[model samples]
Target: MTARPTKGGALYALPNALWLTFFFLAPLLIIVAYSFMKKGLYGGVENEFSLRAYALLANAGIVKVAFRTLLVALAATALTILIALPVGYNMARSKNQTLKLFLVIVPFWTNFLIRIYAWIAILGNEGTINGFLRSVGLISDPIHLMYNQGAVILVLVYMYLPYAVLPLFSTMDKFDFILLDAARDLGAGKLESIVKVMLPNVRSGLVTAVLFTFIPIFGAYAVPLLVGGKDGYMLGNVIADQVMKVRDWPFASSISMVVTFVSTIGVLLFLARQKRPGVSKEQAAALAAEAAVAAGGGR
Candidate 1:
């Protein structure tokens, strides 16, 4: 027999369902609809339906911008993952809970914009490092620290490190270190043991971390806007400029829709990868029953 959810549980789900339907689902539908419509002469979506907006996406100039943004986003994600993996592993294994918690949350306490602005202040031509170097007879002139690709990437990494860490750390909490010890005892070296035992066990966490860092980095605007020069700008900045500066709402919506589609595909791919081999609920139930009988837990 199928078990029914309690009334309280049903009520609890109702609010979330309604919230998603209105806020998430509805806006996505609007963007999708806008993508198919024609751009009006007066900087709005025309009433007529057309594929011009999507067709415009294939234009060489626009495609170049999109491609550049994708490259930057992917690079930023890779860096975030590389940094987060080791930090998360350390945090997960550390004995000091207070230190771990402080490291995890302290960056998040500061306003996100303020944090980006702080990077600007540090990375500007008159920034701290350059000034210190100049004072110590290291450089005669201040270096251009801000408004470059490196600065943009630095800001992106700093902004999203906490996001990547949370997923990785949470997954690390579920790590089975016994497997590593067994591998080592069976003649595996330290690196080999980590690769064969630890990595496989924490694959889901790695996937989660990649997704958490990737999606937000792909959509990020603030850091890029602050530190990014014209060449350093990402798709999100382009979208913002189109919508607010250029007033090309339809084109902006189209870009947003494309990003949403790409992000959805990424999430679906991650879910597919996480699916276990030859396992289903029915199989699990049968196995559980067999185990119960073997252990004398069955009634």
Candidate 2:
């Protein structure tokens, strides 16, 4: 039977509802409200309602930063997914899934800023990579590895890889490996068998991973700030600069709205694809549902 919320359930849900209201929904509504208000001469938003903040999005410089943010986010997300897919598949099939998952999650035990700085130690110009190369007499000058778009993307991938892996592993764990053998018997190539048979079944995990990695990277700030140097400007930095440096709170709120909107849409997309617990999708139905998405085009 379908369960319905009882009148008494409000008592049980009150604390969580109150928590979301204060911590999440309240701030989100404030940002939405501020996005349409006038920017104050000093810092905060003015009482006067205006669309100037949204209008500022057309500024050529901000547009360029947005474009760069999109590119970097896409590159980082793609790399994370590519690396995570194999690792997830291996873990899903591993004899020691717990150990592999534990190792994947160990990074989270450290403070995020410390982890970023740790990368700096490894990738900085005079850091570990260069020191090792110089010790081996590989070169005279230190190789420039830090403070670029590449570094930002690389670090982003490293940071978000586990998010992709966990979701992919969760979905792939349910996948029927026997489907691959059947595809092989039908004369499918190895890559074809995996891509056509395996990936189609794991669409939920792939979508989850993509959204999880892409959204966070799109709004990345510290990775770009510490490692991106002059070229790694992104929308998150723009929002920070507007609020802290430029003192344009309205503009910052508007950009925050954009990020929030994108995140909401991603969540909706995930909800649309999520399979109900204890229910399974037929392979043909799954392929049909995801054809326009995963397959992209014909062979």
Best by TM-score: 2
lDDT per residue, candidate 1, 1-299, as tens digits? 67776778878789999999999999888878888888778788888888887787887877887887788889989998899888878888888956885766765667777777788778788888888889999999888888888888888877777766765675676687778789999999998998788777677667666776677778877777778878788888889998888887788888898788889988886667567653344543343333223222101
Worst 10 residues of 2 by lDDT: 290-299
Judge candidate 2 against the unseen true structure and give its global Cα lDDT, from 0 to 1. 0.82
Cα RMSD for predicted model 2: 6.6
Model 2, 34-128: lDDT tens per residue?
99999887778789989999999889998899889989988999999999999999999998999987787766667678888999999988789
Clash pairs of candidate 2? none
List the candidate 1 regions with Cα displacement exceeding 4 Å.
Answer: 1-19, 277-299
Cα lDDT, all candidates:
0.76, 0.82
TM-score of 2: 0.88
